[model samples]
Structures are given as structure tokens and as C-alpha cells.
Target: MKKKFSLLMLMAFAAAYPQDVKAPDMSSPKWLRNAAISPDGSQIAFSYQGDIFTVPANGGSALRLTIHEAYDSDPVWSRDSKMLAFSSTRYGNKDVFVISAGGGVAKRLTYHSAADVPTDFSPSGDKVIFSSSRLDDAASSVFPTPILSELYEVKLAGGMEKRIFSASAEMAVYNADGSMIFFHDRKGYEDPWRKHHTSSVTRDLWLFNTKDKNYYPVTESIYEERNPVFAGGNN
Candidate 1:
């Protein structure tokens, strides 16, 4: 019987490849990073599973901010705690994007080909400070490297970005009045997250004065120092 033989073949194929597949467990998420608290200290934003999320600082249900398939990370809150600026790979490169604190459509800020990562928002919250390896000075002779990025700022209303500093300064956070910036300086190629290993390649803390364009060393310890943020009252 030809019909009987066809049914047997179909049964064998179904048994070989099952239709149901188990989904990944999300009960306990691990490897969440780039957590930052809002200026008002009401909620905390962070990156997990290639998306941004916010949870109450006092411990509560987490709110999903981004639901896109693209990779998004580094949620930096605005000074007023109404907006968030983050880096996403939706447009081929890591470009800066801003979204409301309550979650909504995101607005693209930077359109450069190089990766742009948001470091902090301006004191007035009209512009966002980011770091990118876009270009260097025409007179400089140093070789180009992606690890060495330059600081830049883009308007929140959307426009061309302006270069702030031409050097490798990562994870930079602004002071209260935007007069000074506390950031960690990179000397050479080294794993930023590699801890407890002390060597010459370790990163150091520095304070950059916006008025004088000068750099002041904050720490000279052999241990690695990264992600320096200004506390209350210029401390």
C-alpha cells in the first residue's frame, strides 16, 4: 500500500526531529553590567542580555527599557533623571541613543561609523558626552588604535558631534558643575576588567579640568583603577 508507506516515512521524520524545543531559563540572570543609579536615587539602570533594564533602588520588579534584537548596553541616566543615553549596535556600529526613563522609542544621536559609547550627560542635560575612535589630529604621528578613543559630545536634539579631547579616556563622569571630570586613563593595551594583577599596564585615575585643559593625577598606585565618578560637594 503506497499510502501506508508514506505515513511510515512521515512518522520516522517527526520522531527524528521534534517540533518543541526548550527555551533558555531567565529566572536568574547573570553577567548584568554597567549599572548606574539615577540622579534622584530612585531607580537603577543596567545592561543585561544585550538590552537595557531598570529596577528600583529599593528592590522591586525590573522594567525592560529596550526590546529590540540589537545589542544595547551602558545606560547612563541624565542629570534630571528623565532620560537615558546608551550605546546600541542597531545601525551597524555602536552609536549613541537616548530613550525616556519610562521606556519608549529611542532617538539616535551619533551617526559615525566608529563605535560611540555614552560616558555621561552634560550638567544641563542638553548634550551627551561619549567616547569614539573617529579620528586624530593631522599633526599627530601615533599609530591608529581602536582601544585609544577620544572624548566627544553630541546634542540631545541631534546634530554633529564635537570632539572634546583627543586621547584615550574611558568611563568618564562629569562633576556637579561640569567644571572637572574624573576618569581613568589608559596607558597601554590591557584588559580593563582584569583585576588583582598589578603591573605597568594598569590603568590610573586622573582629574581633567575643563577650563585649563590640564590633567591631574589622582592615584599612582600599581593596582588598576577604573570608572571614577565625582561624589557630592567636589569630593
Candidate 2:
């Protein structure tokens, strides 16, 4: 009887004095997308909660670069690491826009009905290259379809956009000397929500020579390959 009474008194005392609870950390937000590390390897820019943010590559507090209500994503760092170009739906359809690394007014780079998604900045950082289905090249023999996208580049100063490649090139980037481009070809569209299945229209990586205007397949696998990149200065 004495032991039971002591135990009950201890339980009552513990229930009366609860431990302190810590608050949840909101710094590391979830569902971060389109993360791109700067060329200098100092900072990382990503899309989180419908806005763009930059944080130290080593990990630290995140700095919000954009606070717009419209959906903004696809952050691409310039070669110099001083600027960032991203896609935004501020004007209805997705269009390419550029902002400073430190954050400021975003300048619209492309204005077209077709969605312009910035893939990478030019080697000289003078222009921003993007993928769009606006039009097929005049010399292109492929049929006109929305599934296919063409590569186009608009000057940072903002002028007429010149079509660089007439095929469906995605995640395209230039080599060190700008002599070649590495990208993956999108043959056609597929239902992303459907179950994964192998098909003949799987994406393949390709290397394109700027001088000859010719492209060669880097991978001929039956499975899908994507986002090709050059490593260690080797073309």
C-alpha cells in the first residue's frame, strides 16, 4: 500500500510538470526543385515554395531571391556565377527571366506564347539559351508537333531570338571552348503519372559540334539517358 501510494504521487508530480518542447525548423523547406550549383562552386540556387532561393553550397541559411506569387522555377546559373536565369509564369505562359545573384528586379528575356525554359547561359554569358516549341526550323524535315522543342538563344541585352538547333534538345549546355554542346534528345512526350515502361522513343544523349552544325549520338542504349555533361575539361 505504501509503495503504490508513492508511485501514484510520483506520476502525479511528473504529469504536473511537462518537459519543454522545441519548435519545428522552417529553414530547410521541402519539395525544393531545379537546384543548380554555381560554376564557382560557392552557392546553390533552387526553387522552393513557388520562389527561388540561394544558400551556401556548404549549407547555411537560405536567402530568398524571388517572392513573387506566380510560379517560378528552372533556375540556371550563368557561367560567371553572377546572374541567374529562370522561367516564370508572371505573364501567363512560362517565359525566361534573369535576375542578379544578389537578387533584384528580374528582367524578362523571352516573350512568346510557347513556354521558354532557360537551360543554360552562353559560354560568354552574353545570351541565354532555352527550349521552346514556338516553331520548327525551316530546314528541319521533322513534322511539326508540340512534343518536339527547338533550341533558341536570346541576347542578354534582349533582341531577336536565333534558333540554334531545330531538334528537341533539353538540358543543353556548352563545352569549355563553346565548340560543342551536350544535351539529351526528347523524341516524344509520355504520361509522367503512368507506370514506368521502356519504349523506343526513350531519350538519348547527343553531342553537337557548333562548327559543322552536325550532331553525333553519345548513347544508343535502349533505355532512357538524360542530362549529359562534360567532365574534367574533356570535350
lDDT of 2 at 13: 94
Q: Residue 12 error for model 2, in Å?
A: 30
Query: Which pairs of residues have clashing backbones in candidate 2?
Result: none
* Residue lDDT tens for model 2, 59-99: 88888989999999999999889999999999999999999
Badly placed stretches (over 4 Å) of model 1 are 1-25, 139-142
Scanning candidate 1 in windows of ten residues, the lowest lDDT window is: 136-145
**1-235, model 1: which lDDT tens digit per residue?**
9999999999999999989888877877889899999999999999998999999999989999999899999999999999999999999989999999999999999999999999999998899999899897676565678888888999999988998877678999889888898888777777777868799978888888999988899999889888887777467
> For candidate 1, what is the lDDT?
0.90
Model 1, residue pairs in steric clash: none
The root-mean-square deviation over C-alpha atoms between each candidate and the true structure, in angstroms, is 6.1, 7.7
